[model samples]
Target: MQKVEVSDRDWKHLLDLRDKVHVPGSPAGSNSNPCMSLYRPLAERTKPFVLAQVGQSLDGRVATPSGDARNVSGSDGIVHLHRCRALMDAVIVGVGTIISDNPSLSVRKVKGPNPIRVVIDCNGEIPADAKFLNDDGESVILIQADDVDRTINGTQAVKLPRRQSGLDVEDILGALRKLGLNSILVEGGRRTIARFLDAGVVDRLHVAVAPLIIGSGPNGICLPPVHSLSEAQRPKIDVYNIGTDVLFDCDFRHQYQQT
Candidate 1:
């Protein structure tokens, strides 16, 4: 990836933001700052790619203590995520995230073309009334592992062969490419992001760090042994400030190539 230098003042701003956002007291409190731990620069690539977009607290918690979405990030941060989504070709999430969050995964309140909604449901058990199934305008693609009933609620279903673990990342990417998706935004729930990072399939990462710490609960990403931070070499990052939040945009092209 190409390199661009950030001014010293901007770098200091990022460090300061990271320090202030991670409050050490209550789960619900103001003055909490979240920092996006992006792994690469955004303007250095020119390939069909994947962008991992996530929101996390100072302590790395992606959700509230009870898994509720009450205050993962403030209104500004949430809107920022939607804005990023508006620029991508598609928005993707894992099956677990779909079941838990029941998110529409669309770009709302942002002026841009609506990205296609992509769900990685290894199991063919998506709820019949899931919001994506009935969403207007945005195309929904459900990647499942079986040929189970596809006539449910007018949603498009793409079947993949079942494996003990889950959907194959390579096959999924290929399919997305076939759908004319040049860039994909992975709005994940930990496991999915970790899997892609571990597989070395991610091209870029866009993390929004809020100035608050959940202190505990689920993390933003979870990788296997091989993809552990200690094992995998660190990628480059380009930091940007949006509102009171810090955005860490990272890319990892030197270590691996898209197959």
Candidate 2:
């Protein structure tokens, strides 16, 4: 990934809005700059927030069949993700993402504090040296099954009661809440984000669509089947351009189900 482009004056507002991202919600209106208009919802959070993001091709493929996803989002999408990480209190991923991408999960592209790193490893499957576990003075929480006695260095092992589907989404969120990580970003592989989306806990979803089209690859999202158009989710959407990618910011705040 490329370093943060500080010279993009159009999006320079992002560098300014990175830290001051949460205030009480206000009436909606469009701003002249798409950067400000697209990011307004994030700053208006009045309660705990959970959001997920995915970058894919126009054909909806996140990676080739061989699992080569490097540079799929291009430079701008990568920068946007780093900004999101800076704005959130914590960033989460599943064991699959750790094994596949080995992401550092830090706000390296922008100038801001790194969010606490979190991993949902139900049975302690991720290796100790995974990049996400690299100690940077910030907290790291490994959510595993209560029966799993294993622990990882550079992390606070927080085990919760597991359910049939690994661990219940509600249980995981509750555990994070007690740790004071309110603004959460579920930055992950498709399965993990789909699990959270299916649980109806995600407050927003960002789908950044790139221009490339890989005919055979893993899709950006795979959720439980919805029979028809009416049965599907119809979120309030705000569109914006981030370089060669088009971002569809889907607001699901009112759709979140309280536990």
Candidate 3:
């Protein structure tokens, strides 16, 4: 984390960075804004570039005990999330997020083409009228187990081998990559992000922390228990302050995960 805080003065530069996000030789290559730093590496990828994003409270709660996670992140954080979606080929979430948030998962906050909206529904739980599945000019993919036979109308289903954790992450990525969705965002509830992290498939992790603290609720991440701290992960991280929240851009590739 850099000690110097990024303020409103950097907002225009940040927006400029967002505009030319994936262009390798663009002006973003010469800039030092945290926005440019957060995404430049993952941009323009030929292979799979998986990024997991989460918006949580200070104490690391994604939602309250009552499941009220409506706006944990303020306006700025919300825009930042949308900016992330704009840069990716697709934005992914689990069925829980669909049932709870019913997010459109489109690039409404920024001026960019919308990415494919994907939902993981291993148990055939998502409804046909789910917001993500609705047509909004972008493609939508539903990932499920092969035996689940059911389909959510209008979505392209990609069934993979189901494991104890869920559908295989590698197969999911492979299937998505085959469709040219190389840059993926795992935007979700806790378990889905944890599953990807545990699978060692995530390349980067964007954790946007809002100012307020939720004393008790579901944690942002609930990974498998490790007896000792030595077994824990210590990825290289970069920090950015985008008004309402602090973004921790963690580089998991080559640190531990197989990117």
- Candidate 2, 6-34: lDDT as tens digits: 33542344434444543333222235446
Tell me the lDDT of candidate 1.
0.68
**Where is model 3 more than 4 Å wrong at Cα?**
1-28, 135-137, 254-259
Q: Candidate 2, 188: how far from true, in Å?
A: 1.4
Return the candidate ranking by lDDT, descending.
2, 3, 1
lDDT of 3 by residue, 114-140 (tens): 879888899888977876666565887
Cα deviation of 238 in candidate 3 (Å)?
A: 1.0
Candidate 1 ranges beyond 4 A from true positions: 1-46, 226-232, 254-259
Give the range of the ten consecutive residues with the poorest summed lDDT in model 1. Answer: 36-45
Backbone clash count for every predicted candidate, in the order shown: 17, 0, 0
Q: Write the per-residue lDDT of candidate 1 for residues 98-205, one digit (tens) a residue.
A: 788888887675444577888887767777778777767688888887755554556678877766677788888888888778678889979888878877888877
Q: Model 2 TM-score?
A: 0.86
Error of 1 at 129 (Å): 1.7
